[model samples]
Target chain A: MPRLRIQIRDLSKTFREGGREVPAVSRVSLDILDKEFVALVGPSGCGKSTILNMIGGLIAPSAGQMLIDGAPVRDVPRQVGYVFQKDTVFPWRTVTRNIALGLEYRGVTGPEQGRRVGEAIRLAGLAGFEEAFPATLSGGMRQRVALMRTLIVEPEILLMDEPFGALDTHTKLNLHAELLALWEAKHQTVVFVTHDLSEAITLADRIVVLTRRPGRVKMIHEVKLPRPRDVIKLRESDEYAQQYSQIWHVLGEEFAGHAV
Target chain B: MSEKLKINFWRLAILVVGVGAWEWLTGIKAVSKIPGLYFIDPFFISRPSKIVERFFYLNSDEVRLTLWQMLLSTVESTIIGFLVGVSTGFAAGLVLGRNDRLARIFEPYIIAFNSLPRIALVPLVTMIFGFGLLAKVVLAWLIVFFIVFFNTFQGARGVDPDLIHSARFLGATEGQIMRTVIIPSALAWTFASLTPSISFALIGVVIGEFIGGESGGGIGYLIIASLGTLNSADMMVALIVLAITGIVMALGIKQVEMRLLRWRPEYQQR
Candidate 1:
């Protein structure tokens, strides 16, 4: 196995709301290898987003440790990038300016900053809407801007929390294809949090199934599918069906426990 | 008709109808002497036509300085007060807002100062600053400062945590985040407080003039002089000018707001 790019050791998070302790995650240990796309799949309220937030150093893990590239993740490190479910693009900034924010904040100026922003915008298929504000853009287009905003910084690890959960199926599919194409080219380590099994199967190299609520890792499934596979075509295959049924079975057990 | 025209038409109608009714009831002596009818005497309320005529007359020369000169003096003080008040308040708010410990330490003092009857301090300010244009400007600044300070404090404190987190993850330092994220986010709130604060500045200047410089300085001075001799028409003329000034200032603020906040999406109700 490749040297682990990200290592989470018995990670957990608990929130205090209204003077009560609400446990969110429970002793979730995992290893994500370099250049691997790992999909974190679970039922709603399974702390999927919480894990991603912890990994991104947006929130501190209550009772565990996180190591990225053999170093402890103490704060929001420059090597880590996060894409939120909601559009985090500044409404006041135009597409080009918004995408350039990371580089700008890092003190990259002049022609080099412009070149990087331009390249990311082009990759995200947002070339013509460079000057458009977030308000003027469609939901899909705005999310693209959000993605480009993070991608332009050239982070080694990208942590996404249900990045396309709000999009329609057609838009979601298009983004999935676009993301996969980009990921295939760059081969950065990605940890994607999602509830959709199909989305997990479509993008991830290995799927990590998490149990509900005080979430813990239930199982890990390797894709076994070849690289450069077409998303639409892969779903039609027998392997995809078998993999889907198996993951759904494990997820249903968590749902059954949750229902009680 | 278009929305703008329709709104303008209604506004004009309201002004005409309201003033016409006032003119008929109080301005015309014949209307007041109608059998079995008691009406407000024109001497008390004054006629719109007489007020307008008095306004023109005063503009030419009713005192040592023309109405225009007095108006210019009042505007100067108000503008100075507004600029000084807004800048200081915004700076203080941003500093206090970013530092929770500092905000807590000074909260009581700020509240105490804000709660004190500011108008009552006019006499004290007049005594210290000598009833001049400086006194009026100081009073205007004092009144406007608290209003803007409170709004800006809230605005800076209320910046969305998500945005801050996003900015931090994108490699912004504390100083960079303050400039690029916090300040811009606070701008909408700062602007929201502007209109009321500006009006307060005008009120402060007028009150200062009314209390001290009653001879030949401002519209408030003219009003006081008119009231001394019970010249209701002259008083009304001064009031009309004040009203026009207020409306014009409000419109100017709205234009500035629109220009600065062009990025905000306009939401329409269906």
Candidate 2:
């Protein structure tokens, strides 16, 4: 078994606005092993993104602790990378320059940065548009650039907060495949956040569903689908249907809570 | 291509017709025999041909210094003022933008200074700086500083917070974020603010020269001298030159902006 890469213990976050406290996450704890692909799925406003933000060190936990590789996160750690839900690629930088941002920040040598940027650009299907600005590229292409930028830094843990949430269906499907291939190859501890349950099932090895607001772990489903599973084709398989319903059964109660 | 050519042709035609009508109306020798048929006095209105003729004569002669010298003086003041104003304003905006407390502390004073009629301060500035290069430069700087400062401040504040967060996770230090992200973002706003500052810088120089104290000769001074001597053609000639100078200066700034901001998608079209 791989060693634990991320450990969250008694984690809770309460936001104070105008002196009124609003809790976002309460005592939500999870242990993600090295090379594990975990998908956090919940209804909207469920603090899934808030959890990811804490892991990435973009925000602090109001209580408890978030540890990466056994060390508590005090600030943004260099070993962690994040892909935001929104287009976070700097529009002023060219595609190649955008991908090389992290490497440049780390003070990697010029030639090394260029080589890594070239490889990541090829991996992300951004080979030809190296000099194009983000504004000129399509939404999908910019997101690919964003992914390449995060990956080029080679962080040990990747925390993606609904990175493909804004893409069209066709683009989303293509990106899902691309992301899976990249994750499988790198085997980095990946924690992806999504509101779509089927998406969580299609991509993750273990799906952790959370309840609606003040999100807490509701259930965890271990997907038994074989390796190199085709997302769309796997949907028709008996095991896929069984696991989907099994997870949906647990999620149904969470959705009901959302109405009240 | 034909549509573009037609537009250009119409623009030229309008200019020609307008100038021709003005010349006809103000024709001194041509209307002298018509006996009270004059709608305009040539001595006051000044025909375009007479102005051009006056331009050539002044170009060769020195009436309160040569036309070239006066233009050079005005250009020098505008350039000095622009450089000082833009650099100081951009630097101050960058510093205060990151420090919210300092920005808040200074906000009221900035607003008060910006609201004052800048032209009304010419007498005070001339008294302090003594109607020299410094006076004109100070006046031009005052005209440009507030416009660029406000835009730079807004631009720095408006930088996408998500991008900053991403950069921080990417291991960018505070200085790195400021250099690669905040500064470039503010540069766009600074450039937008610069377009108007170019005209205002020139206005400041002209206004300073028109006030006329010690460091006495510029295009503005020539216009003032011409008006004083009732030489309407000289005044018109100087005004035309000033207009041309303003256009040329604006075009020069545009060229620099285009070259520097080629990374921009919208500007890439040109």
**Per-residue lDDT value at A251 in model 2:** 90
Q: Hey, what RMSD does candidate 1 come out at?
A: 2.9
Q: How much is the lDDT of residue B108 in candidate 2?
A: 94
Cα-based lDDT for every prediction = 0.87, 0.88
Q: Model 1, residue B97: what's the lDDT?
A: 85
DockQ values of all predictions: 0.75, 0.79
lDDT of 1 at B7: 100
TM-score of chain B of each: 0.89, 0.94
Whole-model lDDT, candidate 1? Answer: 0.87
| Off by more than 4 A, model 2 | B28-37, B62-64, B213-216
The TM-score of the first chain in every model comes to: 0.96, 0.96
| Cα lDDT for residue B149, candidate 2 | 88
